[model samples]
Target: MHDTIFDQLERDGFAVVEEFLRDAECEELVAAGLELTRHLPDAPPTVFSTTEPEQQQLKDKYFMESNDKISYFYEKDALDADGKLQLDPSISLNKVGHALHLLHPIFRCYTYSERVKALCRELRLLEPAVVQSMYIYKNPGIGGEVVPHQDISYLYTEPIPPIGFWIALQDATIQNGCLWIARGSHKSAVHRRMLRSPEDRNKCIYDRPAPVYPESSFTPVPVSKGTCILIHGNVVHRSAPNRSAASRPAYTFHVVERKGNNYSEDNWLQEGENAPFLNIYTTSQMQ
Candidate 1:
């Protein structure tokens, strides 16, 4: 199983670990997520949210609908729109993220699970420890494409070596925006480009040759709720617009080796390097 996943990742830059969590585990996670969602405030309106005529109109504009429960343990100026990087006062009371960060079995499984450790041994990344995570929820009626991009572009780590585990909380399918990877694309040299301004979000860089793969190039990673997809940090990946009748929820956690480790810096993209604190939201009444 390890070899299969390893080979797939080497060839495709990503692999799906089917049934990584049992059915009961999926149910448990969903329950925990539901409980958490009840207490979280609705997302602050984005540009599209206020301009649209209705909730469905907003969904129509972005081609997607998602309710996010963000845990912001790490804060950096990188995400700051203006010069000031302030803790969002709206989320100051959120402390439950610590529970998800340190104790969740899924988080541990992605970071230090035996299978993952063995894979790390093969990849030779055992020095620095794993250090971060974030969860995502994509509800039905959400439609948007995650444009083609490399994960390293956003994180900016030196060695550019991190792994993202996308665990499904509900069954994922092609109709529901399941992930698609460009085979053998992880070998490309890293590039750091400016974040697209709101007006230029659809732009694509064309400086380098596009990565190559077989004619049967794309692989759709579909799995039952509770399975996971392990992906390389540098892989070229994206997803289709969700057009399914059901909601497709998933949690993605990014893990990296702990700080102060010697690694490749030749192709490093200069960017933020701080460990973010966990951001949590709860709807529970204080006891």
Candidate 2:
């Protein structure tokens, strides 16, 4: 299993681990998420809009109005009369820095599995560390396409290298905007020019034009409920808009090496500061 996942990630810049979660665990997580949403007072504002420029601008505005921390959780609620909750979505990001310790065992098991460690070896990262995790939901006709970009571009890290595990809470099909990856893209030098905004320009490592990969060389990765797609930090990837009749839900966790080669502190978020959904935890405490 490890070899297969590793090989796929090497050749494609991403791999899918199928059935990573048991049916019981999947149902539990879904229930918990739904329950959390029930407590919200209002629905979350849509984050995606038409036009790359408009989407970029909205994202920039959200970042500025939000805390400096790039990781956090969002909850949207439908309220009843007298300010009671009707329904809601419980979403969060930055799991490692925020709530890994508090996560259900099943969720942690998927991220910390041996297969994941082996993939880290293929990436040349040692003593891997999970940086954060994000939980997101797309209600019917509510989610939009995630622009093509690299994950490392949004994070502040010296080495600018990491791995991502995107777990699907429901069936992720092409119609639901499953993830798309540029095959073998991670092997190239990091691109620095595709960014479309200037608000947090420095936060992005790439400034060059978007590199085009032939469709024949790339593939859309689809996974059933309870599966995950593992991707490299430098990998060029994106997701289509969720067009499925039902809501689409997913989670993403970022991991990196602990004391491995190419370690740098320049881009690391300052300790004790709140980032997105992540609270603060020291390196030692994380272990």
Report the number of the highest-lDDT candidate.
2
Candidate 1, which ten residues in sequence have the lowest lDDT sum? Answer: 278-287
Writing each residue's lDDT as its tens digit, candidate 1 over 68-176 gives 2233221121124752424433222212231244445544343455655555555555453444444444444443445566776544456546677778888988888
lDDT of 2: 0.55
Cα lDDT of model 2 by residue, 10-114, tens digit:
777888788877677667666655554444334333233333443332334443323233223322222334433344334321111223322434444545565
Off by over 4 Å in 1: 1-4, 46-123, 194-217, 259-287
- Candidate 2: where are CA atoms >4 Å away? 1-3, 41-51, 54-125, 156-160, 193-217, 261-287
Model 1, CA-based lDDT = 0.51
Q: Top TM-score: which candidate number?
A: 2
Q: Which 10 successive residues of model 2 have the least lDDT summed? A: 92-101
